[model samples]
Target: MSNSNRTPEEQALMTKAAAVLPGGSLGNLRLDEEHAFVVREGRGSRVIDVSGNEYIDYLLGSGPMVLGHAHPKVIAAATEAMMKGTTFFTQNAYAIELAERIVEAMPCAEQVRFVSSGSEATYNALKVARAFRKREKILKFEGGYHGSHDYSLMSLAPSGNTPFPQPEPSSAGIPRAIQDTVLVAPFNDLNAVEDLLDRYHDELAAVIVEPVQRTIAPQPGFLPGLRELTNRYGVLLVYDEVVTGFRLAYGGAQEYYNAVPDIAAIGKIVGGGFPLAAIVGRREIMESYDQGSVTPDVYVPQSGTLNGNPVAAAAGLATLEVLREPGTYEAYHARAATLRNTLQRLFDEAEIPAQVSGIDMMFDVFFTEHPIVDYRSTLVDKTLNRIFDNTLLDNGILKSPGKLYVGACHSDEDIERTIEVFRLGVAAVRDA
Candidate 1:
């Protein structure tokens, strides 16, 4: 493997980062030494590295820059808010306004509570569910990623062939007892989920899922079936919309799929590239967050120092305003569809055993002939994927390890350029 062109300054920065940061990364996007490059700044749909090499960025800061990096409105909103003050730890107007916007957009959000990250949001959501339902256990899809909390880490990426309804801890330091609290089921398999619910619904406080499991879109009726099963069994349904929130639609996955959940942990685009997240749900259920409204044992004692940072709320509000503009989704979806379809067509014509698995806005090529419906089905050629991703990086196209996040800021030119790189990536995989 050849290292891409790297300037001395860039090399020095990487060396410094490797010396301090764990595994030379912030534990998000990790590239091999050869392909790794430190990003200096991002504007619109492109990010510039310290080496002054510019790449059309499809990672979009892991799906937060929906309106693209350094958006003028988002910057202005954040800047204006920052000038007033950063954080008061008390209720601020920006946070209240942002919460109102969230309730207005999300179908299930009659009440909202802010957190600093998606992990906190999911953790608190689960806590509230457990409190509301008076149950200790929760059911999550095998591959669904809610966040890095102990409950969310269960069966997130189990290497072993763990059987249904039995969770294997995906991370170390998680207590053995945590395994008993989480039940696992296959994604997109309604029968499996229903069976698990039937057997363990009494113990399950909630059934949490990613509306789009990683890059794989939920099968039609899969979400609705989950809702019905959870309702029938008197278990709460939770949607981890950290990625899909405000990206799939103004109302997130619930609005896009027309299947609402009882509670949702949302982040990513809702934060407008900042570290902000929220747990939104029905008024009755959310009452668990209010200490005065609930019994001492049932009330969730949740508080974060930077939970409702005014600057992040301001940025989030600006992002939502832009998304609400007329014809935004129509135009954005059309552009993404064109790019996704063209890539799939290219791979098919090349006769490569690939499946462009995901919705138009977010997707990646899985180098397998078999259909990608669930987590186990996704165990395909990782080597081929590495080659394809590296090829795109070499050609100035930046994307995440598993998915390509198409942004609203991707211009016609960016799409065209990305498609050309996709062809190169496909050919590289085919030849390999």
Candidate 2:
């Protein structure tokens, strides 16, 4: 598994990164030392490492580079905005235009409040929900990752099997008191959600969830059921569409699923591969952020130095413009569906017990026969999954540890090559 091809210069940089950066990473893509390599640049559907090795990048900057890295339109827009000066504390034209586009696109977004990252967007979404509802507790689905915030960390990756409606902090340093303010429920389970909502609806401000929880698609009626339950209980429904935003559809998961939320946190593709995210919602609920709209006690104060940076907004605008073009999603989804289905067939043909989970546009293989309907079901042979990922990496197909993001930038040739690699990965797992 050692990367013997590492150049002297790349090796030196790796050593330097190890000396300075924690775990030699910026808190993402923690690869083994042997397989890890510093990226030089990305273009179209490929990334070249410092050692001059090229990889077909299915990770796509963790699902933001839908049009691929260094797209001419995105680069030009960002460059023009950068030339005009990057950040301003005051509202800018680009941010305003972007907000208007989001309002038109998202089913739930009557108004928009920009933020710098998905984490900040979700945090503020919950805060505003609590403020608007005048409640304290929030319910989140188990293993539904909204962000790195204290509330999001609850039940993110609990080692032990905790009981229903109870949360186990996934990370250290989260205060024990914070656990009481948060509740956890299994994704795609309507009965569990209804029972919890019935018992704790009075204390709950919002029921936040990912419409597509990680790679697991919602069982039919799940999203609609959640919407009905949240409405019946008088609790705000917040959709964390950071990964699914523009990638799923122009209007995001809400539009694709046809189940609108009271509030939504959108990022990833909306930023066009930049540091930007937003909390968007209906006007009545979003008014919590406006000091003048609400009393001081109920107003939720939120701001960031780089919130709605003009450069990021311009890139997002350009990205959305491309996404709005007719047939864009049709082509993107068809190509990705080809790859996803082909991979599943390959694994099945090889007699490897696997399930290629998630939607066509984004998915990954689980080396298990059990259905991947919820978080607990996702627990399977980690070693086999690692081997499969490494096999793809060795063959110059790069993907995230959990999911493979399919981008519109993937060419016909790129998909064909990846299919070849997928066969190799399937065989590797079969042998293992």
Q: Encode model 1's per-residue lDDT on 115-233: one tens digit a residue.
A: 99999999999999999999999999988898899998998888749888899888899999888899999999999988888898889999999999998989999999999999999
Model 1, CA-based lDDT: 0.92
Model 2 lDDT tens row, 1-432: 247989999999999999999888988678887789999999999999999999999989888999999999999999999999999899999999999999999999999999989999999999999999999999998998998999999999886499989999998999999899999999999999999999999999999999898899999999999999999999999999999898888999999999999999999999999999999998988887888998987899888999899999999999999999999999999999999999989988888888999999999888888889999999887998888899889989999899999999998999999999888888888788
Q: How accurate is candidate 2 locally (lDDT)?
A: 0.93
Model 1 pairs in collision: none
Q: Which residues of candidate 2, in runs, are more than 4 Å off?
A: none
TM-score of each: 0.98, 0.99
In order, what is each prediction's RMSD in angstroms?
1.1, 0.9
Q: lDDT scores for all predictions?
A: 0.92, 0.93
